[model samples]
Target: MDFEKLLVWQRAKALTVSVYKEMAACPDLVFKSQITRSALSIPSNIAEGMERFTARDKCRFLRIAKASCGELRTQLMIGSEIAYVAEPLAAVWIIETRELSKMLNGLINRISD
Candidate 1:
């Protein structure tokens, strides 16, 4: 299956793009770098996982993607608290991360079975 065809991958990709666009003007270089990295990791890992030959390898990458979702969510929460990110936008991104994590979990279970 192509990673691009997966809804989870598509959503993750969108989320990454949103993060990049919204944080483009952020002054906190360190925080922006960390947040963007976490956001980017989600779809990147999904793509890598889908390209893997074995279920174990695929699941490993999916797990990494899921963890990235958590990392991104945490960063967004911090960004909101610190005024780096707007509260409304941060809330939306946080929800997206949760949804992506759930999607990744479902995909992992399906691939494992």
Candidate 2:
């Protein structure tokens, strides 16, 4: 399957774009870089994993992408808690990450089967 055609990839891409927009005003270099890195990892890893010749390798990368989703969720929470991103904005990101994670889990399960 083309990773770009997957719903999870689309959602993750949207989430990453939102993350980038939210971080635009953040003056802290460390947080900005960390959040952006995690955000980009979600889709990049997915694409990289999908190109692999083995399902196991693809699953491994999907798991990593899922982990990155969780990390992004945590960072979004932290940003909201620290008054960087608004609560509503953080909530949107949280929902997006959760959805992406769910899709990744489904894909991994299918590969395992």
Candidate 3:
């Protein structure tokens, strides 16, 4: 299966772009870099896994992507708590990222089984 064509990959790519745009607006370099990297990891891992030769390898990467999604969600929560991010904006990102994580987990489970 082509990772480029996967819905998980598409959502993750969009999330990464959104993270970059959001981070660009922030004044703090530390949080910006961290969040952006976490966001990028979601899709990057999926793409890297897709290039692997086995379904097991793909599942491993998908799990990593899901973990990154969780990490991104936590960062968003922290950003909102500290006022680095607006509540509504963080809410939107959290919802999307959480949903994507769930989707990735499902895919991984199905493939592994």
Candidate 1: give the clashing pairs. Answer: none
Task: Report the lDDT tens digits of candidate 3 across residue range 64-105.
Answer: 999999999999999999999889999999999989988998
**Alpha-carbon lDDT, every model:** 0.97, 0.92, 0.92
The collision pairs in model 3 are none
TM-score of each candidate structure, all chains considered together: 0.99, 0.97, 0.96
Q: What count of clashes does model 1 give? A: 0
TM-score of 3: 0.96
- Regions of candidate 1 where Cα sits further than 4 Å from its true position: none
Model 1 lDDT tens row, 93-112: 99999999999999999999
lDDT of predicted model 3: 0.92
Superposition TM-score, candidate 2 onto the true structure: 0.97
lDDT of 2 by residue, 1-113 (tens): 89999888888888888889879889998999999999999999999889998999999999999999999999989999998889998998899899889999999999879
Superpose all Cα atoms of candidate 3 onto the true structure and report the RMSD in Å to 1 decimal: 0.9
Candidates 1 and 2 compared: the better one by TM-score is 1
